[model samples]
Target: MISIVLIGTGNVARHLFDTFRLYDKINIVQVVGRNEQALAYFGQYSKTGSNFSNTEPADIYIIAVSDDAIAPVSQLIANVKGVVAHTSGSVPMEALSKHPHKGVIYPLQTFSKERKIDLKNVPLCLESDQKKDLEVLNRLAHLISDHVYGISSKQRKSLHLAAVFVNNFTNHLYQIGKELCEENNLPFEILNPLILETAQKLETLSPCEAQTGPAKRGDLSTLKKQVGQLKNDRLIKIYELFSRSIQMKFSRD
Candidate 1:
């Protein structure tokens, strides 16, 4: 059995805790965090505490805190013999350099406490300074996920940037779509089929090949009409910017 001490009580930590508890091979030794209220959630399942100086001995210490807090939190467990890994996509493994056995276990998916995610489908990116630690992390990752990858810190940074463009920026665009639908006295759910189809198309078609719309076709009249329909200056600018970017990308093809 692989014993784990999970640090942090945020979305990622909560999701991991919920998933790990289901597996018989994994034993959650303790969960440490600064917030007493957040710690209470984990207290029901395992040992919980705010004191980082005195933590339970485990085979792996997973720090699921924010990127900025990773360094300081890692320092608190520098003397541990177990592998110290941070769950961050953009932050480098060196953030846990204080510990001799440092690594990264980044889950490439957006996490929310309310949403139940099938971690088996979520991609797990693993990196470690030590070979033995990597093996251990691989074993743990495989227990929950089928899609596991060995990613370098540099590659992980690039992947994270791409994720921002695809996930975060795309979600903001969806909000804009929702507002536009509301203004037109239409339900935002009208776009659900289009959104689903677009996502499903990626399974077989490359993003460039999946490209469509007035912007990609270079339909100036349609584009102008669509831009003119928007009353908000910010929305108009965003629409124009995206249209120009899409046109520029496909024009070379």
Candidate 2:
């Protein structure tokens, strides 16, 4: 079993730790962070401490901190004896170090402490300085998931950008829907099935093919009436922008 030392105790770090417990393929020897107090509770089972700076390395050192902290944290991890990796979608693999066996093991999913990652289904995007190191990453990935993909840093970044639009931006729309429901004294849970169905449908149909709306149909009367129903100024503006974009995309005029 690969001995892994996980760094960072944030959302990603916490999720990865739970994944280790679920898979049982890797021995999580330690968890490190810059803040001692922050990592204290996690140490109850595994070895944990402060100091992003490396004391000793195991088979793998995974830095699952924020994207902006990637380089600075890696630089602090001195005296690493094994392959080092980070979990970030947009960051490049080379940020680790040219001398060390560096790689990126970025999981393409939104992680929340309350929501557990179904490791058997997560798609891990991996890249490395050498083919052999990639094999190590692939092994670790396949231990938890069958959906490992070999992606270049460039493609990973592109995919990350697309994810921001689909996941983050789309969730904001859902929040707006929830707010509207609350104002109307409707239970937000009422939208759960609709949301799930919308996601399921995209698996079979392209978004353009699945598109269903007054905007897509160019129903001018319905579109105008729907905008009039929005009480919020910002949402009305957003509806206008999206409507224009959708119309332009479909109509081309």
User: Which candidate comes out best when scored by TM-score?
Assistant: 1
Can you give the lDDT of residue 180 in candidate 1? 94
lDDT of 2 by residue, 1-253 (tens): 8788888889888888888877567888888887776686487755577756544558778989988988888887756777788999999887886436889898889998788778678899988878777888888898988799989999999999999999999999999999999999999999999999999998999888888898999899998999999999999999999998999999973
> Ten-residue segment with the worst summed lDDT in candidate 1?
38-47
Candidate 1 wrongly placed segments (more than 4 Å): none
Residue-level lDDT tens digits of model 1 in 1-29: 99999999999999999999999999999
Which one is best on lDDT? 1
TM-score of 2: 0.93
Which pairs clash in the backbone of model 2?
A: none
CA deviation > 4 Å runs, candidate 2: none
